[model samples]
Target: MSSDPLDDVFNLEDRFYTQGYTQGVEDGARAGRIEGRSFGMEKGFEKFLESGRLAGKAIVWANRLPKKTAKQKDASEKSSEACTLPPLPSNPRLEKNVKLAYALVEPDTLSTDNSDEAVQDFDDRVKRAQGKVKIIERMLN
Candidate 1:
């Protein structure tokens, strides 16, 4: 027995609709993943760049700190001509802040994982480092 013509026509339309929907879903899923990965990489790069900048500032601050021992002072004085930055006044609090900032954004200490906990920790460290930088700048000015 042959199927009814009208039924076949309706079934054809339904089949085409289903196929189109499936194709669209597959395409969308693929595109979404690509876009998400690209976005994630860009954001990660930006965060790391900022962290590196903060770390660099910490290193410079640490270097510019006055040497403690007589022997150290003599060594720094010899190299002081190469160092354009004037030595930071010997303030215990400033020294502490600089050290803390360096520890916060230190590359070896930070995780590169994409996990939620790792990301959160990275963000927290960066934020703390930023606060330290601001405090150091204010003290300098």
Candidate 2:
């Protein structure tokens, strides 16, 4: 069988095109995965930081609340040196709101998974917690 030089020359362009396409696809897939992971980590950190900040506010609010009983007051006094915030006046509604806010942002109970349901729940909880913080701030002022 006689090979044709013209055929080889004609096919060179197609061969190069196929190889380039394959390499491009592989590179795109790898780059896509890296970018996806980086984005996920950045978003995850932002969410968790907000949740933690809310949780810290809840703790401070809880601590500033007036102690209800002698036993509670004594216990709080023992640790009083650690907190400088003046006790908030005893208001049942304010106390309840503070407690609710704490529960909504409690880090231990929140899920860290990236699944749709988990992310939805986390977002819902954070939104509710932010609302509670606003309410508590209004009550304080």
Query: Which candidate leads the pack in TM-score?
Result: 1
Which regions of candidate 1 fall more than 4 Å away from where they truly are? Answer: none
Give the per-residue lDDT of model 2 (tens digit) for 1-141: 598779988999999999999999999999999999999999999999999999999998998988889999889988888877788989999999999999998988999987999999999999999999999999999
Top-lDDT structure, candidate number: 1
Please give the lDDT score at residue 27 for candidate 2. 100
lDDT value, residue 25 of candidate 1: 100
- Tens digit per residue, CA lDDT, model 1, 1-141: 587768977799889999999999999999999999999999999999999999999999999999999999899989998988899999999999999999999999999998999999999999999999999999999
TM-score of 1: 0.95
lDDT of 2: 0.93
Error of 1 at 92 (Å): 0.3
Measured with C-alpha atoms, the lDDT of residue 19 in candidate 1 is 100
What count of clashes does model 1 give? 0
